[model samples]
Target: MVEGEGVTARQASFGGRGARLLLRWCAVSCWLVVPIPAVVLFTTDVPWWAGVPIQALVLLLILPIGIALWFDADQHREDTGRLLRAGRPAVAEVVELELVDPGDGSADTAVLRLRISGDDVPPFEATYRGSADPEFRPGALLHATVDPADNLFVLRNLHRS
Candidate 1:
């Protein structure tokens, strides 16, 4: 809706695009690209004296990702702040829930069905993910805010422990 909302979201997402790129390179280094160079360098047996330079070089080449991730975080706060500042208030009722675990190292996700209604706003049902507050149960009422321009909403309370 607004030109800067995307910018705000991005900047707030990872201290902005530059930082995001840096972190992406970090994830790349940590999980993706490092193996390529690692294989190339260590494929052959090397003398004990060479191990220090090999490790140093690898660490030097691989450290940017760590720097990048230092700036990235779960970005709910940015959206939450934006919505709370100007978005319309609403209440969300938890209608149903399903927990989906990918079985990877990633966080387990909670899929929720919610019914949201507020003054001057028609009721609506939507499926939301676990970024919402953690403690909601079926039939629970939770605070929410809707960005009128986009109808994007965020649950106001922090999710569970």
Candidate 2:
């Protein structure tokens, strides 16, 4: 619980960092693998009539997956941006922190658990990931922007003064 501009926020389960990574990987793999069968069929001695249909069949199977993955990624960004722009000012307290190990194992991802305050809303818990100030430890008070339409969605703009 935090004392500041009182705002309504609810706990919502949005996709975390792992889900985003999986989506990106699926999109990229679809694109990379789709061309392989086409290239192999085209280079073979198969006639144009036989090769064309096979190539089209291969593309027909994989193109939709690629397109859907891209669309999902785009939609996620649009939704998050819309929520952030219309968010109301609020305050939250850091409850926990989880460090995510990167795929290349270069650096760790910083994830924070926060408890948001609202009059009728329960003690809402939300997680944020990205770079944060060193002072943002557990029990620290932080400013946040919560979506009025959906209290479960929030954006913590910690850099703002």
Candidate 3:
């Protein structure tokens, strides 16, 4: 095998469309995190004023942070895609997939470990962090864009189905 033999896959949890949906869900869910606490405090007579500050913090700070984090994560993935595109490596196959449990909130997304090999290339593993639906199973064919400049970038995105 070649010295730089590996595979890369696109990280697809929340693409542009998915990100929009996440934002909307976050907006709707944000109320539950703060409002519920405030209401309970007020009703239970545990100093409703104390809950006001907490609610303010959640609305003014937590919500914004969550939204920003979500966007940042999506942007990072896009940047990776661009990097792969710029590198321009040959396509590879996702020969194997091993999913590691992600302890994050996005349980729907799976963590993928790929096995790749090519002639004149040394086999290697590339771990891709992305969320695919639970329905995505092993041995699913995925197209990868490789970075010729850096063969280590065996995994990249052109398209996947």
Pairs with backbone N, CA or C atoms under 3 Å apart (clashes), candidate 1: 26-65, 133-159, 134-159, 134-160
Higher-scoring candidate on lDDT, 1 or 2: 2
Q: Please, what are the lDDT tens digits per residue for candidate 2 over residues 19-64? A: 6667778988887877776677677777878777876876887778
Scanning candidate 3 in windows of ten residues, the lowest lDDT window is: 6-15
Error of 2 at 48 (Å): 14
Report how far off residue 39 is in candidate 3 (Å). Answer: 12
Q: C-alpha displacement of 16 in model 2, angstroms?
A: 18
- TM-score for every candidate vs. truth? 0.48, 0.53, 0.43
Cα TM-score of candidate 3: 0.43
Candidate 3 at 31: error in angstroms?
Answer: 10
Return whichever of 1 and 2 wins on TM-score.
2
Pairs of residues clashing in candidate 2? 10-151
Model 1 agreement with the true structure over 1-161: per-residue lDDT tens digits: 44324321111121344555565566655655445555655676666467657766767766665554543532534555566565677788889988888788787788888887677334666677764346767999987766655556766522222
- Name the runs in model 2 displaced over 4 angstroms: 1-33, 44-65, 118-123, 131-135, 158-161
Q: Please, what is the whole-model Cα lDDT of each candidate in the order they appear?
A: 0.60, 0.66, 0.54
Candidate 3 lDDT, tens digit per residue, 1-161? Answer: 45544433343332355666666567556545756767777688778678777777777876776667567656656655655445343334444455556677545445556654444333455666555644345665454554433444434454343
